[model samples]
Target: MAKHYPPLPISIWRHPAHILAFGFGSGLSPKAPGTVGTLAAVPFVWLAMQYSLMPYLIILLVASLVGIYVCDKTARDLRVHDHPGIVWDEFVGYGITLIAAPDTSYALLLAFFWFRLFDIAKPWPIRVLDAKVHGGWGIMLDDIVAGMFAWVAVQLSYLLWQLF
Candidate 1:
């Protein structure tokens, strides 16, 4: 079972693990840290886009894998199961959400909103996976699912727009 954790202290930021786990400081936002982290990730999408699809996908995979370690170590250090301030998952999730998405302002905006909604709402399997799973995968999978859900909505909207 996950132990209850108090809000993180300023001192926590000094550690390298915490720094990465906190979305490189975006997670430090006084409010809606996850949303902030996801938004902060938007600019980075272009960096991944510099590569072709396969390379971008590989980058996502590697980042996600690294996120598991970052999240796990940070949680263990804090003695918390999954801290709200640990928003590296949000960054990675948003990256996954925008993969293969059309590089349009509208698409990016829609993806940002959709990913935030699904991440916050935690619908269906997202909520289920969050609870049933444990450890780092547990923490990351929920956001990944949320990203997929958001990605689907964005893709469908693009397709529907083309038809109309």
Candidate 2:
């Protein structure tokens, strides 16, 4: 029974496990947890932009590697694959999307919506990849693809805005 429930603390935000398990408290949101998790990534994205592209990519790569183990472990503990509470993949995915956009409220909101749409819809290659992949990579890859699409969309939007 305990394994079935996501481990919670008296003060969920203060719990280290909760922060890790819930993707920095994003899962605690009353609305769609995944969306919340993606939204929560904006601040990190802002901070990451301070560095060069190479460093950002390195950080993402490291997160991907670590996310595999950490996500898998957390999922196993909760006895579910891609549990809502285990939102690290969403965080990473959104980070990837925001990497391509400038730091602005409009860009952030656009990236968020686009990423969420692709993620929830699981269109095309995204669906195929999600089905074929397994473990943490599986958990993260679909979102990665979604983030790619989101990035592309943001770029297009910027281009269109400039043209008009």
Candidate 3:
């Protein structure tokens, strides 16, 4: 059985916070850690959707604040900048994508896939920002940009699908 752990600044695999922040080792997936991390966020979104937006926003805000430090520390420990296992950025990015989205399984899944696509594509500004920015904020900003792109795509898809 998989053991639940939390995010922490020290040892990543052992820390409960790190484990949760890394999406229960989904981020550790050999291929496309970011993709796995974003996918892992789907359940949290479902739960968050049950609560008021304010509370959800609050949790996202806290993660954003701590992500800076945790990301940095994890990167240092892993000997890589913005290591894939340090996927708190993906968590926040997915949260952004889901903002105001309908509370439906399909909607959440759509947002999840779209966010993952944009994050991987890293087009235009997202790629530019990812390259230019540095440190925790940089790590977070690329995902944020990707999330914004995904958000737009989700809205457009929703409208178009409704029209059809």
Give lDDT per model, in order: 0.83, 0.75, 0.78
Q: Candidate 2 has what TM-score?
A: 0.83
Model 2 pairs in collision: none
Model 1 alpha-carbon drift over 4 Å, by segment: 1-5
lDDT at 77 for candidate 1? 79
Clashes of 1: 0
Q: List the residue pairs that clash in candidate 3.
A: 5-16, 6-16, 6-17, 6-18, 7-16, 7-17, 7-18
Model 3, 109-128: lDDT tens digits are 89988998998888999988
What shift in Å separates residue 110 of candidate 3 from its native position after superposition?
0.8
lDDT of 2 by residue, 1-164 (tens): 11244444244455454466578778766557787887777788778867888898888888777777777766565566667666778877887887757768888888888889888888999989877887678877888888888788888888999999
- Runs of candidate 2 with Cα error greater than 4 angstroms are 1-18
lDDT score at residue 70, model 2, on the 0-100 scale: 70
lDDT of 2 at 45: 73
TM-score of each: 0.91, 0.83, 0.85
- Between candidates 1 and 2, the TM-score winner: 1
Tens-place lDDT per residue, model 1, 74-109, is 878777777877888897888888889877778779
